[model samples]
Target: MKIAVFFVGEVRDAGFNASALAGADVATAEGLAEISIISGVRYDQDAIRARLAEVVPEVDGLVFIGGQGNITTPEIAAQYPGKKFAIVQGQKTGPNLASYDVLQEDSAFLAGALAARLTQSGTVGHLSGHRVPPGLKGRAAFVAGARQANPDIQVLTGFCGTQDDRTVTKAWAAAEISAGADIIFTMLNDARSGAIEACREGRARQIGNAMDWVEVDPEVFIASAIARIDLGVKGAIKDMVAGIIPDTPVHLGLAQGDFASLSMGGDVLDVHKEYIAKIAQDIRNGTCTVPNTYDGPEFQP
Candidate 1:
């Protein structure tokens, strides 16, 4: 069997994309599947449609990794109605399309809780890549979690509008810190490093995304909400290969090991470990509900 994975941005050095690629590699190893990966610089509907038309015929299945906005766009879906497609972040329901959405809000909530517990100034900030649903959901969940931990906590917010714009993001992080935000949470693809730099320069703390950034900024990076998209993609491929594709979306969360908070590499502070453990248990026990970009409440700003 052959699978084609279309990503929104280049996966050359991105931690999140690398994780998804690792998942794809695992699927190939187990199922003897041939995989082809493609990435575009922007979420151009016409471009994605043209590319899909050119490549879909040769592949057995399609996997859209990350970039919730671009993958869920109506234009792309309309062009490939009958093609078997699976998306990682957002929900796009169709006859041949399935979504393996990550329970990001839950993970973000945990990160926020940890940030609140670790912050010394009682002020946390969220640096978003865009004002889009996924980014906003992460910020909102973080705020929700932080509030739960400390109602008096002040959560500042900012956005870079795109994931690749590191300069603007660094400026935003610096501005947030200048405004008295000591603990920062960045939910960007490659912009996480820029936020880390701003934090390091400003002498603040940060909660990294996708993977921990302890090696780069150990003193500042308190934790990371790591996502493993490979498991979901591999499972989708298996179902498609077996002709067992489900009519409903495949939602992966802590239960499926698709998302979690990592304390490895000294990314998580010792003080926040207990809080992270408790939140992880809450997610597993269904007591703590995390938000979904598609199903959760819409966020403004």
Candidate 2:
């Protein structure tokens, strides 16, 4: 089977795109499918649609790598019903298309809980690049977790326009710190450097997403929401290779092994780690519900 792994940003982003691309590389090496990577498309809708149109006709299957695919992938898949389509971290699905989500929100919730417990200023912040569904869900879960941990804790959250714009993210992170946020939860890609710089200069701690940022920088990162995008990509590719297009999106979360987790740095207290563990169990046991939508006002930096 000939399958194309598609992305809307730089595949070497060292964050979301990098994780998904790693999975595609493994699948290709294992001979699961004849994989072709189609990257370098901008975040613009027209660009994504154009790239999809150009590539979908030539491949037996196309696996889009992010929630950006929730829109254009379905439209393109409908145009080519004979071809298999899947979206990792996506919500939409059709007969010929499937979506697989690695529940980052589960770990985002734990980050919020940790932030609530760790913040000395009684305020925390959230920053993400796009206003996509997965990012929105993560923000909502973070806010919900913070609220659950401490109802009076303040959460200043915003969605910056660009994921890779270091200047924009740096300014945004600084603004959140200026607004009294001591711990910021960031869901970004290559733009993460800006947030790290802001945190370091401002003496504020951070929580990261998609990969284990705590492992990368223990001093700046207090915790990391680990979401295995690579696993989702591999699962979608395996399904596509086996010609199994499920009717529903494949959902993987904390209960599904280490697909999603909240990794804490050495600075985290033992008691707080136990608290986060209990919360994770509650989410797995359905006792705690992570809100998917945040209707509250957005903090504009």
Candidate 3:
């Protein structure tokens, strides 16, 4: 069997790159399957349709790489009807499609709790690539968790509109810092580097996304919400190969080891360790559940 993986943008983004590599690696290691990758900067109907027209017929399965792009567009869905496709990070349901909805909001909530406990200024910041549902969901969950940890905490929010624009992200980070946000949680893809730079210059702490950032910037990065896309893609492909397609969305969270926050080698303050531990335990024990989208109550922390 062979699989074709489609990414919404350049392969440099850690989240998307990680998923593609994970899928390819799994296919290679499994010996019975082969995998290929196709990347595009645009998710427009025409672009996606053209790419799929060129790549879909040659592969036994299709994998949509992680990003904010919508995989359920009518054109793409109709073209690949009854063909096995695995979508990551976005929700789209079909008879032959399996969606891997990573529970990023839960990880964001833990990061928020840590920010509230660690910040000396009692103010936290959240920076997103865009105002899309995924980014907004993570931001809202983070703010809610921050308030749960510190009721009086002030949460600042901003967006860069695009993940590749670092200059705008730097400006937003500086502005958030100027507003007294001492700890910043960043969800931008490649734009996160700019936010990290701003945090370094402004002497503020940061929470990283997709993967840990302690090694990237030891002094400023306290912790990160790491997404295990490799495992997710492998699992999806394996299921398809085994003829075990799922009827509902495949939800992966802390409980399923799809996401985690590593404090090892982090710059987290001692005061925040207990709170982080508590939240992690609650997430594991099913005592705390965070929403994936804004369909829940408005988070005001």
What are the lDDT figures for the candidates, one per model? 0.70, 0.93, 0.72
Q: Across residues 19-72, which tens digit of lDDT does each residue of candidate 2 receive? A: 899899989889999999999899999999998889988889999999999989
Q: How close is candidate 2 to the true structure, as a TM-score?
A: 0.98
- Worst 10-residue lDDT window, candidate 3: 292-301
Clashes of each: 0, 0, 0
Q: For candidate 1, give the lDDT of residue 207.
A: 76
Find the candidate with the highest TM-score and give its number.
Answer: 2
Off by over 4 Å in 3: 43-45, 67-74, 262-266, 293-301
Q: Which candidate has the top score in lDDT? A: 2
- TM-scores of all models? 0.87, 0.98, 0.89
Model 2 collision count: 0
lDDT of 1 by residue, 5-38 (tens): 7776667546567667777788877864678887
For model 1, state the Cα shift of residue 143 in Å: 1.0
Give the per-residue lDDT of model 3 (tens digit) for 94-161: 67776776777877888888888878888888888756566787888888888888999888866667
Output the better candidate (1/2) by TM-score.
2
